[model samples]
Target: MKLARLAGPTPVRDKILAIFPGALGDFICFLPTLDKLTRDGEIDLFTRTEYGDLLPASVRMRSLECYEISRLFVSGVEEEEKLKRFFAPYSRVYSWMGSGQPDFVRNLTLLSNGKLKVFPFRPSVSRIHITDYFLSCLGAGSSDEITPHIPIRADALAWSGRLWQQSDLERKSVLVFSPGSGAREKNWPPDFYATVAEWWEKKSAGKNLAVLGPVEEERDKISGRGDRVLALRGLELGRVAAVISRCDLYLGNDSGVTHLAAAIGAKTVALFGPTDSVQWAPRGKRVTVITRNVECSPCLSPVMKSCLHHKCLTALSPDYVIGRLEELLG
Candidate 1:
């Protein structure tokens, strides 16, 4: 109940609704705060349905369609009265989607009108990790030791075991590589990943590359080829997380998959480019972030609109990543 001290003036109530939409890593970053919130009472989640299995069974997960009601409220399509009535049951609604949809915060606050408390999280433009920002939104102080919370179910672990067994790769020390990200600009070139895979295959006999992500669904983009390199494209999110959980190391871009890998306790070597590594890198005990010190780097913009050449990622040579990979593996 102590962690229920959210930003609004209203008293803590029996139930709370947390509106968290897309971007898997963002949701993972908010998990620690969500875990703390659950101590107060049952928390209803509004996130992408794909992540429902990753969360604890105690919490109730809702579909993405359920969150469209807020879009209507923000767009003025739904009347303020209807919005108020729809959310009246919950004692308070805490939203972290304000950064993407500023109007959602304004409309929700207006509709609440002191009847229901509303905490629309909007952190200042500071150089802090995203997880820190998530905690700060709930009035919690930042801590270096604070890590993302991801609970791997027993079944997920079983699934991972089956994968290794099926491939006759049970004894091999696995290295998961997620070569793709939502933003193409942030990704280190696929050739860089292939170089690492090649080096890993030669250097270590009992090693495997568990290539992950939907990006591989487009086969032409990546040029990695080796019997040891297993492409695991289009697997369910939970299954992907499960497989990464068993791996000894994870090499990836600043992507959601990297966040999941780190959250589940894999040693992570994340290559960050346009996105600020200081503010967005994965947070974990064994996480190492590699980035080029380009002057115009970390544009902090969601899209690479202005810069046609992504020197930040391109400059991060494969040798540099391989060196880091060696340091972690050793």
Candidate 2:
């Protein structure tokens, strides 16, 4: 009698490792390149563990908190053998961290046996769209479409459904707002968002939900609005994506959640003030970017911080944003 054969696990074709320390928006910009790389080989990413849910299933995520990993930044390798052993598994390693540090590049190159490639954390002087810049770093052509996609897990969707039911938003057209960004200067005023929310509810009879991260949690941007508006605070990135995915439309400043909203394919309206929307706007066919073309607009972080009067954003009245929303939804 012939014995039945058991199939073993499939071997990874080409093992690649990437060390990325970018925030959510940067990671979103890097997603297309990650997708491209996945076609060539299996990838292991060293990044914040919270981003694990956002990555493709083929990619394995490793925590960047390893003490040994931090040793790569030191000038002299005190644990050369251990570091070399750790890096021996991958055929090549790409790092978005420590590109500006000569010691890190030199040490990592030596330890990985010259298998390491380093790219800048972000574009230095170039005003190119970040997605295109990442592709160019890989010596690849521009993406025909720059839309970055994140697949919502079944569990995440279930969580969203539960949240929607709990929030009394089931079967209602919802508009989600992310009113804050990493920089206060980039924000288009909480009162401005409130004005927009009032208009959104009155015009469309839709529920407005404001998602706030650590930065905006203390500010109470969208409270005292009764049942027409709800505020979601202290949610993980995955849950935030899920909630945004269930929304009819999304509006936000240049925050990571805004990028996430676009990546999740929500119809998004991105507000731009100090930042240049041309280079950093969320990429999607359904996304609209609103900016004030003031002569002193698109200023750098230094200028933005020093600016006494933020006319660039304050000038963008609630009426203008509502008009844009009408055009977008129509």
Candidate lDDT scores, in order, read 0.75, 0.85
Error of 2 at 317 (Å): 0.6
Q: After superposition, how far is residue 19 of candidate 2 from its true place, in Å?
A: 0.9
Looking at model 1, report the run of 10 residues with the lowest lDDT sum: 113-122
For candidate 1, report its TM-score.
0.85
Candidate 1 per-residue lDDT over residues 1-330, each given as its tens digit? 467655868665567777776588888888888887788777888788898868988789887576444464456633556666866677667766664555665566655554333444545766877787777767889887999867787887898898889987777767788888887677788777777777877886656555555565324444347575777767777788888888877889898988988888888888988888888888899788988878887785644656778888888898877777777677
> Candidate 2: lDDT over CA atoms?
0.85
Point out where model 1 deviates above 4 Å: 1-13, 67-86, 98-122, 216-218, 221-226
